[model samples]
Target: MLEIRTLYDGTGALPAPSLTKILREAYDGELFFSDSSSRPLIVGNFVQTLDGIVSLKIPGKSGGADISGRNEEDAFIMGMLRAYADAVMFGEDTFRNAPGHVWTAGCVHPTFEKEFHAFRKHVGKDSLHPLNVVVSGRGHVDLDEPLFRHEEIRSLVLTTEQGAARLHQRYGATLPAMVHALPGDAALDPSNMVALLHAEYGVKLLLHEGGPTLFSAFLRQSLLDELFLTMAPQIVGRSRTGERPAFSGPLELSPEQAIWGTLLSVKQAQSGHLFLRYRV
Candidate 1:
């Protein structure tokens, strides 16, 4: 059993939880989000080191597991969030980096698979797993990946019109997932994507597990609602090569336009890793 100590919580007025007693004891805290019928509530989850390096950018070890050192509590929290989400969205790079990853509550933390499923059922989620959303502006996703091969998991791909043509030519109608062609060139508008998800899929809570650039786009558009950051107790300095990336990339926010977030809750694992929830 992972022990997560709550340092502070300011989310009392958010929403009341109807979680089962088993989940309440396992989580040892309450988490709720504001309702939005017009659009899905966007929440981001990321883990960075003390030096603010999110990815090592190495060939084989560029995922969050290396940053969090495969912490059990962090994985549990990720699974917990997945349980509450209607869909889990990430960039093409994130999907590529993790070869066989599935965006599901049980896939992240297998030990608590039953608890996560129970939580989802309590919340009235009809799907066995949250929808896996891959946002690729250029349609650069590999169709042979496990996520696409898995017949049980519902997947969606959002890309540009040209990208849709490319994917259609490459994979044709044999592609297992739904390929949506949005009106854009290279970059997709985050707001439009959210609106499409809300209108078509009825996604109330969308989890953004980003790969830096995608997160920055959402932040710049002010479409992101909340951020759940895990501060790993390690420092990996940025090299002169500049391959290592921080939380957000490419888009630099000036002092006048900086987005500050309100702290909602703080939790610390026994391994000194801090879990921070913020209302952005």
Candidate 2:
């Protein structure tokens, strides 16, 4: 087992439980800052290389795993965050790339299934597996994917007016999920999307594991409350002149316009990778 060393912990004054114990079986651990259990507290999580390159593929695979070195510690931490979330929000392209993937504690970190469920029960989640949410502006998702077709899963397609129409015309009759169209004006608005997730789906904590475009939108809209970042050990050098960084899309915050954050905690894995949590 990899040792987890805490270099800092501004979020908690008390000594944190062992990383394994905390990752597997801690529910008294505060996961969100919101008072309401049915409202959304959006948190974004990602792992990026030291070179500021999130993916080596200028047109690479969509899942973070492909670019994140497939570190076991990162997966475990992501599973813990997923265990806390009421729903897992993904960009449409991300959902499409990981064809059979499900956003669940068990799916991401299966070794501690019993412990994860125990923690979920302690937190009072209605279901063990989180609801799957796809956020899309253009709504170009392929609804026929196996994820939506699975009977055991509950999915929400949050898309623009045009995107919703595209979905309804092609797969409305067959898609067994909630297809909600964001108000025409609020199509790309991340805050409005959070409001809808809370009001319609009763999501208290929305965990976003992304494709960069949607993650950047959350940052732009100031919808994110926290960021869990795993700084990977390798340097995947950026080659393209206009290559995509960790968070893609139109985001160029000058030093003054930059988002300020409080460093909540830092955990250093045995392999020298850093697990950092920030309250933005």
TM-score of every model?
Answer: 0.97, 0.88
lDDT of 1 by residue, 1-280 (tens): 7888899988886455756676666667777777887799999999999999899999889999999999988998899899999999999998999999999989989998898888888889998789999999999889889998887789999999998898999988787679999989999999889999999998999999998989889989988899999999999999899889887877798999999999999999999999999999
- What TM value does model 2 have? 0.88
lDDT assessment of candidate 1 = 0.90
Per-residue lDDT over 41-93 for candidate 2, one digit per residue giving the tens place of the 0 to 100 score: 88888888776666555344635776567777788788888878888998877
Name model 2 segments beyond 4 Å from true: 13-39, 58-62, 185-187
* C-alpha local distance difference test of each model: 0.90, 0.75
TM-score of 1: 0.97
Backbone clashes in model 2, listed as residue pairs: none
